[model samples]
Target: MSSETTYAVEFAKTSRAKCKKCSDIIEIGDIKILTTTTGGRFDVTQSFHPKCYTLPRKFAGTVDDFVDETLRDTTEGQILPKERDALVEAIKTSSSATKKSNKAPGSASSADAIIEKIKAMVDDGENEPQTKKAKRDDHYSSNEFVAAYRVYQKEKNDELKDVLKWNRQFVSGTKNYLLVKVLDGHVNGRLARCQLCQGGRLKIDEKNCSIVLCNGQFDEDAQQRIPCTFQCSIEDAPRWKPWFTEEPSEEEKEKMDKLEADATGEGAGDSHGDLASMKKEAASLEWNLSNKEGIRSATEDAIGLLKKYNAKLPEDATKAKQKIGPVILAHKRETPEDIIAALWKEVGKQLSNEEKEQKDKALEKTTKVDANAKLVAAFQELSEYYSKEANQRAVFTYSKCLNAIRGLDYEITAENAMSLSKGKTKVEGIGTAFAQKIKEFCETGTMQKLEEKRADHA
Candidate 1:
């Protein structure tokens, strides 16, 4: 990998831009990281919000390796010391906030506590110079670093005793270690280091060496380990290959060059703004599949784009759906209609199990009520549990039955309801199964199977 000096820079955005990774709007004044690339077919520039920026693969495979290069501080383009600390704190804060939010009801106090924790770290720098220097140099030496890495590698095997408990795994292509051939005292000079603090250096002794991190710190003489707050890890790697002597190509070189955009990639002509508009429109509209004309028209539009874009509906869309991204990817071939239909499907799936059960039970109890009210109740229950065809059937029966009964100016009793369900006189939307349910309800004052469903739900 190329030296770290060629990697990334953090700068405040002067104007609006799109986050290259998420393709979302990055408003003006947001702190963003701009990455530079050169020697490519085009001198491509991509900018990311700090949260979204990952050390690209060409820089270093693992966070450990990235830290090593960062600590080397051999070049100006690399992240500076203070910036590096801020980035590390940002990542830690984000992780901590996520865990806390998942486990408890997040309040302002909880958020304040996290801010204070980070603030405390920042204030620690104000200590006496000697104390600060001791803290700064508090890292592992060559031997202890390697030993910590071995401990990290051993922990992967569950049966191993006296091994560190593994907490997390890095994504593929980002691991720090690979199996490498050893020569002399090094695996191509890829030394181990403090993966957490990124402050120490360690020598590689074994051929199949894995990178390790330790929480142990050292005094100024670097003789003995002392307790350090930094947690240890053998993250981003299990094995590594010997450092290659091959020179990087133009593409690889381009990846190494860290450049920021000369100007924000947003303005009057920006597509992100248009996507935002579409997303807002989609959200403003109510999602209801029972509206046949509305939903069918929307679905038809979506189906057309589905074919054009060759995309499938997302597996889980209820949590938060990004309609505009896909629509934009489709080259704006889609309209808000497609988004509406997609959102409707997501809304349907998101209906709670408890809500569905309640609807089912209530549907049975309401069968002897007003014919129009009973059919509406049935349709609501059907929408929750029945197949698409069944729901459609209920929709049709509700509309047609209500219209016929109202046209006759008759009260919704058993005899009047049966008129719409019997023989050749059947209503246009009344199917066999639905007609049977109506007939049974009219004569017996209840639908038997619906009552059974109510019992099961209860």
Candidate 2:
């Protein structure tokens, strides 16, 4: 065996890589053979499915010698003796078939003959009657259909039109009309009627792929439609239960009633414009300039109304009070009109500030998530590597650190890495070793330990 070429047997961690021999996907958690060929500076690695793997013709060794030489030290006791024996048998069978095929060109080998026999058996089974299998639609319940309908209703008008066009239905209609047409096609189509009617007065129109009532009645009529009395033979429930719409819950009904009341202005006393009314009243007040007492009384009334308006808006109330306080104290120097104008200006400024703050917070949160995503991915790779090596303690430690990083509320940047990892408010589960790795990643965008692991595996 050459020292430049080495192999290891392990289960694949992902389904993204293809098998070198068969050119098929090596599915996740399936046994695979990893082949590493050392070059000048880098190592190239290839993976192959267990059954597709073949021993090198140059290697003159027994099956046990090959297995012992290929497997890594960390995976020595992990693979069972029976699994090794199975692998050895598979390699021998593959080698024997190759030699037989080479000796007799254009002739079927033993493996090929066995495969043909299996295929013929499958063909014979296909010629016989098969038990009917349930459909994907039949598995869904009435609530599930209602949920899907709700999602359909929430789609954009263009999306709804596309769905209708794909289903070969009329697409020129309002959103609600399109939705109803699609729903009708699914619920009242030929298959639904055939399943529910059970050979009743309904005839299938093969050309149109539709079902029509034999009594010349339309399916739109409540009584003429498939009767609700039809029972399902499989579950002893209504055969068309999945087509039925679910009724609104109490909370949904209450929300609908509240919307109706607001639209009609019924039992909704001044809740809509109370603040505007108060502001208008304060602005419209007439104070006699000659009478100081009357001006004082008018000022007090205006202030009271402004306070009432502030009370109605809890989110802006505190800021509004701060703005109104100065105006209230300066009532003796400023006129009522000036006082009211100043208070409104302050309210506008506060609202603008709040909006800006909200936008900044949203941007910050987005940046934090992007940064954390990279860190989490790196940690996950390390965790997976440790898991494959059967280092349970390292896997657990890395998993805990990854979770702590994900739970962080702020982004860990190069400038804040030290504070987050070693300062007073250091993150939990991140010890000295993990913190060093995190700091290195934040500064260099890669961890040395992770790179070394990849190089070794390669």
The candidate that wins on TM-score is 2
lDDT of 1 by residue, 1-458 (tens): 23222444445446567888678887775556665566655566676666666554354344545544542332355556676677656544554555566676233223233223223434554344544434332222123233333434333223221111111111111112211111111222333333222223232212212223232234333344332112111222122223223444566433322110101111211222433443455555443444556554445554434433323344433212344233333333444645534433322122235534533443332233333445444433333232222344544445454334333333455555555666766666555666667667767766776666543332
Query: How many times do residue backbones clash in model 2?
Result: 0
Error of 2 at 327 (Å): 11
Tens-place lDDT digits, model 2, residues 305-344: 6555543222344443444454556564566556665554
- Residue runs of model 1 more than 4 Å from their true location after superposition: 1-7, 12-15, 18-30, 34-47, 52-80, 91-458
Top candidate by lDDT: 2
The C-alpha lDDT values of all candidates are 0.39, 0.52
Model 1 residue 27 CA deviation (Å) reads: 4.3
Pairs of residues at least 3 apart in sequence or in different chains that clash in candidate 2: none
